[model samples]
Target: MIRDATAFLNRSLAVISGIEVSGLALVFGVLAIFFVLLWLRASGRARLAQRALQTAEADAARLDTVLKVQAEMSGRMQTMAEIIGSRQADLTRALSDRLDGLTTRVGQSILSTTRETKASLSVLAERLAVIDRAQGEIRSLTGEVVKLKDVLANKQTRGAFGEARMQAIIADALPSSVYAFQATLSNGRRPDCLIRMPNGAPGLVVDAKFPLESFTALQQAADGETQAAAATRLRRDMDVHIKAIAEKYLIPGETQDTAFLFVPSETVFAALHEDFDDVVQKAYRLGVVIVSPSLLNLSIQVVQAVLKDARLRASAGRIQAEVRLFGEDLERLDARVTALKGHFAQASRDVDQISVSSDKLQRRGERIAGIEIGEEAGPSEGLKSVAGE
Candidate 1:
């Protein structure tokens, strides 16, 4: 390629006009301008072509080197990928085994927790059953008690029940001396009950029987006429009972002018007033007061007031007795004190006489036992005994 380029240059120099050759050097002195222009243009193009050819050859060599390098790297990359995949498989197996064991343990824990919950539920159920049984027994016992109380409220036994209960209430409310029970009125009929008055005198009397069965039957009657009949019978019975008691027990200025006929049941009192208005009006005219237990309780309060005054009087009597006894004791004490003072004065006079006799005897003894009477002179020498004998 260099030889071909040199031969072309020789031919180009030979064909030029007015050109001279100095050995291998060609000179176009006058045509130097054209030559310079042509050389500039052709040299630049020829240099560019040479550079392009060199660059193409370098590029081809570089491509061959790149292909060989890529082949070697591909083999290395494949071997490394196989090794990494085996390690990953080992790690995955280890993780899977660990997860399986953990899952098994978790399942066992869940089962145990479930079993405990079931056992607790069973115990709760048993406790609930026990509570249910206890509630049932309590309800049954309550029912029986209610039935017993209802039976006592019936007319057959209500009178006795009320009397016993009322007596208990009275006993609890007052002292024994403040009241008395079952006192005989002056009319020779013993009143059903009595209370000591303010002066310890007889108090108002009460009769405690009033039938409720007929009234209850009246209440249970299907028709108004039957109810009216029941009412008539109850009212008539009450009037008869009151009249009998009044005839037997009510005496002028003896039994309390107003007497109480206690209706143990309010139902009977209500029946007389509600259905048999005329009979009640008659009872009022007869001066017989119809009283239920509640009304009688109010009447008893009146008796209690009288009893309070009686208690005060009794207490006054006790005070009077204490004062009398105190006066008697003071009189006896006064006599005893007078005797003590007299005895004390007599004892003092006897003591004065004994003192004088002792002084005389001491002087006589001193004269009989005489010695020199010096600074310690004996008293007998200093005294003149009887006649100086």
Candidate 2:
């Protein structure tokens, strides 16, 4: 179409050149308008091409920068992956080591606790055994207490018990030679014990029998009036026993002025002293002394001390005689020692004189040996030289 339009334009221009001058002016105006339109279209096309080139360059720059940024980001991500893997490995190893330590500590703690629990159980077992043994001993003690209660329940057995206790105390405190059990006095009455005093002093009697029924009743009384009646009966019974012991045991010449009324029970004796003071005074006035087991033991100790003093007094002359003989023997021994010393001194002086004589003889023998004689000298001449030396 553009070629056709160019041909048409060429024909028109030739036509216009041959036409009149008025027609050429009109033709020139139309050519100018077409040229201006062509120029404007060409300018618009150039500007569009420049804009497209600028846009393509900008797109290429943006693509290159995006590629470079993507590559850097990939490197950083790879480095971060390596760091994360290392950190994970380190954390795993650290956690493993800590877990191992914790496991070991827990195992040791469990073992220690087991051992401590075993020790505690063993100690508890031993304590339980000790408690079992103690319980057994308590049972045995309870049985023995019951037996003792039974023994004290009977009056005759109780009386015998009191006598046995009194005898045991006396036998332990006094010698058999100094005391006699159930000895018959001159009046044909037998006393429980007769203690022979020292230095031909009168014998002392001990009566072990005591009344305990009224005292037992007093202890068992339920009311005030009953208690008072029991107390009165106990006082009367005590008075009767005191008088009997005083009358039966006391002898003017053969026995001591005081006789012992032995009350084996300290409780009973204390009761008598506390509640029945008048009875004790009456017995004291009648030459009968009420004695508990402790009092009897003490009295026996005093008697033993008196006997020891009397024995010492009786042996005074013999001890003096023996001392005199010992002194004489000491004097003799001293004199003999003095004589022996004198003999030793004389022998030492004799030995010294003998040593001096032997030294003198040795010197003379050396001088004789040192003397030289001529080979041709006669025997008589040598003898004479020796004698002269």
Candidate 3:
């Protein structure tokens, strides 16, 4: 039994050891399984990690390429900024220069306009002053014209004015010696004036009375019938005055052959020529010369010149006579001077002969006085006779 029990214990011990060994083996197997699973998981994780690492390497390469591209773009951008800055500076300077030139031109234009405005104002003021003065002068002239019209309205006043104006013209044109006022002619008729011509005959008579009333009536007549009547009267009046002047003033050997009918106004003379040509022709046939104031003045000047020439001719005769007398006196004076010169020559010759004779007598007396004769020597008879004489 002891042996069986010992064997049983040994068997138990072996079974226990087997069981523990199995458990240990199972644990080891489980550990191995765990280790295997862990190993598998580790392998899967390692494969995923390897893929991720490959992906990271690719991404790093791409990032490095992008950085290189970015660096190049930044360099280009800096260069473009510098070019833009230079362009802006040039534009600013150009605009500033243009503004300065425009300002100067505007200033000069303003000054020119100011000067032109001032000069135009000055000229306008001067013209205004001149216009004012001319207006005043025109007003004064109007007053004088009114007074002259009033003076011409009356017959007596008009006649007197005409006579006075004629007198003034005649006086201004001729010397007083060549003309006479209100002179009587040989026919016992007094004329307004007479102009002395160069001839010794009676002077030219100038009659100033004219038929002005008839002419004025003719001028003022409106209707044809009134004008015709006035013209007839004017012709009749002019014929009567001309016939009277020709009969009274145109005397042969007493006055000029053509007597002057003086019309003081040129308008009257023009009217006679224009409308009264027949009257003028008739007056010419009667030896009557019509004259206006201007014509009369010129005629008087001609008469003055002719009279002066005549006086000069008369004085020439006296001058010739005086020249002849002066020649005779000069000849007589020459003859008297010749006679006196001849007398002076004869007197000089006589004086020379007397001097020669006196010199000879002095020589003889000296010789007689110088002769040293003895006391007893009697003087010569010639010497004694000379001393006694």
The top-ranked prediction according to lDDT is 2
The models' CA-based lDDT, in order, is: 0.72, 0.87, 0.83
**Colliding pairs, model 1:** 366-380, 367-380
Question: What tens-digit string does per-residue lDDT give for candidate 3 at 1-389?
Answer: 98875554444222443463334455566799999999999999999999999989988988888888888878877877787778778877787777777777777777887788888888888889889988998998899789768877777777666767777878888878778888887778888888777657678887777877888899999999999999999999999999999888888887888988889789989989998899999999999999998898788777777777888898998999999999999999999999999999999999999999898789778867776767455677656755664
Q: Which sections of candidate 3 miss by over 4 Å?
A: 1-145, 318-389
TM per prediction: 0.41, 0.58, 0.46
Worst 10 residues of 2 by lDDT: 8-17
Task: Quote model 2's TM-score.
Answer: 0.58
Tens digit of lDDT per residue, candidate 1, span 186-232? 65677666655565344666676656566667677899899778767
Q: Pick the candidate with the highest TM-score.
A: 2
Cα error, candidate 3, residue 44 (Å): 90
RMSD of each: 32.7, 24.5, 36.7
The worst-scoring run of ten residues by lDDT in candidate 1 lies at 21-30
Give the TM-score ranking, best first: 2, 3, 1
**How well is each residue in 1-112 modelled by candidate 2, as lDDT tens digits?**
9887555545534344567334345567778989999999999999998989998899889889988988998998899999999999999999999999999999999999
